[model samples]
Target: MPRAVNARATVTLLAVCWCVVPPRLAGDFNPYGINSAYWNSPSVNAAYRAMGVGTARVLLDWALAEPADGGYDWSAWDTALVHCSSHGFAVSLAVCGVPAWAIRVPGRELSYAPEAFAEFVCAALNRARTLAPGIVQSFEWHEEPTHAWADGIPPLHGTEQRDPSQYFVAILTTTYRAVKQAFPEVTVVMDGIRGAFHHVDDLYQLGCGPYFDAINIHQYQPHAPGCDDPSGMHLFHFPTLLTYLRFMANRWGDDKPVWVTQYSWTTSGWGWGDIGEDRKAAYMEYVTDVSRRLGFVHRVFPELGVSSSTAGAGSAAVVYDDGNYVPGPASLSVVTTAYLRLKVCAQAYPVWTGIPEPVPLLPAASRACAVVNGGFESGAAGWSGAFSVDASTRFTGAFSARVEGDGGYVESARFAVEGGRLYEVKARVKVDAPAPSSAAVWMELFYSSAPGHLGYVMPENYYGVVDTRQYPGGWRRVCWPYFSAPGAYEAFLKFSLQGEGTFRLDDVTVRP
Candidate 1:
């Protein structure tokens, strides 16, 4: 499942919001922050600071802190907060969950109040302030109040599945009053909403405008209009975003300083959202530029500085593993104990080109993968030629494609790929045919020019056919590595059966 629920990826066109706060991110030229639950690790916090992460988010769980009504435990919160504060990072705090004693929805962040939540926030902060003297905290009533477990992390107790507008507003209002009463200087942010376009209007209608000191955005780039690079979706997304931002100013009276609490691509790579590591780092670099370019986005938190199965998000962490601060794919290299590293530490980009630098004049980060229904779970909907989605046989997923006879074949949708890069197609194929049975993977490359002629493959691959007969006990693991010589713009992945009996293909993947 998608970790962070988000609006559909449309062409993005972001302009400066006039009422935005003057950004103070020019000092180190790094306007990035780290959000994760593993801040208890000193090495992880150290690595974050070295990587120029100057802001941190704390998802304070009320249930964990005060398991009993009046009893408070400060171990976890203290470690997370003190780690950031001691490292000189500004902390954005959002209390999460209600203890079991309080009525709460099962596993969902929901509606419950006796003004007790407000009081607990103040008490916790008061103690937190003293624990980490001079600790700076910007408070939000709850973490991701707009969505129930949208971050893919569920609460111990809480959600308002119904029209949550009035209930959310009520809680925010009470929490805002209590927090301000305790620490008047702390900024209270509103709606770093996920799927923000859908929920922003409701929050505004419920009179939530006056309770917030700033606005937070948790928008992530989608895979539809684009995810390979930044430029693809900006076209369709601009109107909606600019209009809503304008809508905020017109309806809510004045604009508030905006902070992108979350912006990142998960490296899970299981479904559509997970991106590759190298490209993921490129996205980090790209978003940093976007943050600097947009006047309203004061800081962009790259998210999950470190993650593990126990706490924080495992897929998107820049550093991961249990008990160890392991550098993730975003790092230049996994330089454990040798030195701290990050994407910014790699192949020299203009050092002055991030944070304070203007938006990059380059295309944004996106994926080039274009295989559709490769798993045949969609019943070969996007594939052509003679094939049937077999229900009985499978490798990992539900169904597999079956091709019979010499004329039978299964081909994928025509998708684009860049030239000069090595590409590979992999699949699990099972042959139940006689001795003469054979299967081949065919390749075809296209140029998107006016005449759009087929590009030539290397001499040996001219025919675009590679015969294979290696079938293991159950299924044969087939892999064909191909390359787009030059001027190749698009291509197709096809598998053909040459003999009598039927062959089953499943879990096909094209890697670029």
Candidate 2:
């Protein structure tokens, strides 16, 4: 990505959306974190608290952690972790970077033993125990292994080279073995990849699924004010990352939550100069709300840090220079205005968008359909996933469940399954906005007696995206009639509304 020099871009495009209310989104504010070189001190951390952010991504800088020639020195990290903990912040540590003792070539990772690296990682978490016990939330593998400088996995260096995928899994496998043995619950993240397309495919194919709890992507979008349409063509758009990452996760059955460990609309001297200070701020607010609705993006961190000697970070720094602690405006500068705007959004974000996992919202239905409160007249009593009960919208009753932004596979209560029995699943769906992906009505099978969920069957008419135009009434009936459930067990209905759109479903019925 080249630097956009002398561009001095204008900002009116994104400013229009400044007043739009955040809709009833599919997900809520996940733990917002930041990777910053400057916000390392206790005083600066108050800035994070002002943003209502409670997590900070701290790189367990190896050189900073270990002393010269002997044992570990925990003080460098202690300063940051202790203050963060005091502010009720959880520290997520990333293990990457070079130590001064290394004799290897620069830009490439030092060829160190995996066990040694794992040991170092464990040591960091253990130290955090004393400063802020159990405050460490996740252990990240090489921050961005796709690149040379960002990679922590040691390069083969003159030896017979390993396949890049093999190298990635090897590091993950080694780290997983040691990290889990130490702290089983702490999420171990994959090497935060820079360019994901071909690289992510190799990781899954090489059986790297079981190693990490979350997938990490370092999203460096080439431009800014381009986040509204996550479906937009420009690839590195952060929300676009959410869309592709979800597909890959489902495709390989590696449905782990995605954390964008690093992202920024580069105001650096790089070609990204198309982004102005105000535009950068607007883009941050845009991606934060829009990406959360995708249902899979659990955490997003706007990266902070670039050498002062190098190209300037422009306005990407939410807080920079000093350790000043102010969430509100003392004086109205461009940076402070942006910070205050973001703070409002953060404060307004409703619930914790729990990591997208199968929620068993099981309570038998009032009727034979086995869907409890299917019309949502009784409100959000039985349904699980993101949606709200709106009295204004209904198919048959006084209310319907309103879902927005790629409503991830909303599931119903379990219904009894009989062998060779065909069932009909029907629901009235209303799409208020355009959605390009197919809406699926499917079943998830599970045995009440023995083994659990046996995966979802293919959608009845999954290939084509739902067309709301043909149905003039606005509310269209979607049906999968005569769909059979083979073998013995119980089943549940799931409606997956894909793509970025506002939709509602009510009057759901199931018949055998």
Candidate 3:
């Protein structure tokens, strides 16, 4: 289940928005603001000021806001808002933690009773408007809704299959109506959902697209293979998220601005030990470069128990231990060394290099397979192969091959196609019997869709320890589903055997 907003923090967000945006846009590029949370002391504020951060986001628990079913408290929030306004620090409020009274139900799902939830949203927004006047601009209703109850944290209300879109539409529609009635100039930003791509389409389908001004996303797994690391937070991740976002944008056609609400690179120590000062500096620099180049509204580095020796490299502003904000060292460096690169792009840019065309498997013919070794061998078949294709080639079809000989064995093999500089690889294998009961076969594929690119390998035959008694024969055909690509691509097959067995390979094809 989701929670409501804290009035004071809401006002702070509006103030920050007004402070950050210039009166006019400059060539599609604009600086919003830098923000941090958990900075309670003067030192933290000083660090944030040094880094040039203009706003700060703070957490406000619902339990504290409304202790009883109908009793409401606004004392702490009133003081916090006054302190922030007097000091010129704009605020972004994060509302979370369901109240005990709200969870009296038996199941995990909380029943809001439509009218009751609507009243709550209206009251919350009205209170916010009264306290902050014109300072509150955005409202992030819940924090990571997807993972809200992942780790055995029972929901305040009973358990039910709660659709996120239902909550968003119900709460946001009511809140937006009330907030706009009170402060029409405010900009309302949605909370960061855990899996944006995975759930965005469903949200759109549920008609939850038109309620907010912009979209918010959080990226924690910066370095997962096949994903992009635009912020350079992770070493191996490629930032594939952008590709999925592009796909969704095309589908929705909403043209909503994107904001990265939370992003940070975790070290091996997980905040318990030192993570080399130089590495920390480099990571920060990388994040700044990626954020500016990619046109994200704001990139926040949450200070959740982190101690960096090189604290000022990548951020436009820093959030320090004492709560004093300041401009970071790299902000100055960016102005001097890469200011021109800060210009926003006119159109979307390709994050990864395109792949080349795939070569034909046969010699200008239709189908063929090449053999590597002969006779009953143990570990003698390990070789690399490839096929070429034209640029921007799209292929979808199946390829088959087999190896036959007296006591012959394949160590490992794969199928693939190459293009200008990219290669796509898929693993391949051959079995003598339909269900091999004795040993397991390992196979792989390799190919590039473009020139000057290393080929990617994909596993074909699923490997596991199994009984070989089910399969005992010769020359069995294994056909796979159609593998397709936008650019040039090819097919590859590789295999290895544990026991002595002869094999013959053949029948490879690619279709549109």
Candidate 4:
């Protein structure tokens, strides 16, 4: 039995849970995967590898698998599953598109009888189990139940008294029970909810909560400003998404994971607004960082493969099907880099038979050269400008330097340095709550000119970039190693915060 919880209590509980829970409890960070429909082309393996995702979604279409009662054909699906396994990618299968024979009205609609569909699902699960063994980790009930048809067949809500969504609850529970009975270890996820929260309420009203392991959602946010068709919708933004997460925790227990099966910002000329390519890349990376920090969304699969047949002129795919589906800037800058970072961070990220696990987060203390009260333990000694010891959050020791106000900079007292020598500067940082998309943290290395005038050299660009956006809400170690320019004698460190968010810095250090 489930206990009743109000929205406020749920959010409070979740907050407490997040504060106390070990940071790495949810160690399984599923890579950004592609939809099975998009990945079934001839160039799937190369595209999948190029995307650098460790998991592949293999959709098992009930319509194709069992054309008739007691009839089965597994050739194409078997081959696809084998290919994914051969490439060392885990598989998540979604069984959808009911066969006409199982439909009560005998139409090409999703309105199929519950008992009959459940039988078909059990048989398919049995076959997949035999074919792939333990490689298939998850089974999704359907593609998108609310928006099942493309040509306006309308979703399956039979009547006011006899809700079609209630029937879906029946199918989900029945199929879930059978799948569990057959394979207790496999994970069962709800059909990716495509419509609204009311439909979810409908399922909950029918007492259909115990059937699945996790909830799957396909949420697409619009492109940022600079796009011809910028999305004005706020539902896809981070704050709204957090509200939805709290709602789910209230409705379906916070322990169950939420998997975002499809997420991306479309390019211009698509039915959605025309967002430019660079903004698309930025949004993709931003959304990825937000989801990871939230910690509940276990998997994030951005739409990578754009199909010429279905996709518009400005397809959102990082790799297109045409010209042998070449990888683009979004693939390298966003998807590939995101995957490598996730692999390095996730505690349970699997290493293949021969591949070695990533090295652990290196300890920064031993390598750091002493700076006056660098850890902020001595209450901001030898520091200047709008900085104070923050006891609430610290990377090491009892306190850290907290910087408030937008565009405010903090500087360390001048430290001796040698010209033309390589040195490393690092800081452990995290954005204070209410972190806006525009909020950023940065650092600069200061030096003296020939005339003894103080000048600063930003390692790479005009403003040295310390990617606070990429940091996962919690404390993260960021380091920059650079060569001191010739004639640079003395040096100092400068840190600043920009936008409407607070930032905490600890263990600020420089070393040879």
- Candidate with top lDDT is 4
lDDT of 3 by residue, 133-185 (tens): 65555556566554422235222111112234324456666666665676566
- What local lDDT does model 4 show for residue 272? 48
Tens-digit per-residue lDDT, 69-98, candidate 2: 347877768877866777787878887764
Q: What is the lDDT of residue 393 in candidate 2?
A: 67
Per-candidate RMSD vs. true structure?
Answer: 17.2, 20.3, 16.2, 17.9
- Identify the superior model by TM-score, candidate 2 or candidate 3: 2
Model 3 scores worst on lDDT over the 10 consecutive residues at 10-19
10 residues in a row with least lDDT, candidate 1:
459-468
On TM-score, the candidate that comes out on top is: 2
What are the models' TM-scores? 0.55, 0.56, 0.51, 0.55
Candidate 1 residue-wise lDDT at 410:
84
- When summed lDDT is taken over every stretch of 10 residues in candidate 4, the lowest stretch is 15-24
Q: Candidate 4 lDDT, tens digit per residue, 55-131?
A: 77777878888889769888767776767766677878778777877777533355577777778777766766787
Alpha-carbon deviation at 437 in model 2, angstroms: 42
Stronger candidate by TM-score (1 vs 2): 2
In angstroms, the error of model 1 at 83 is 2.3
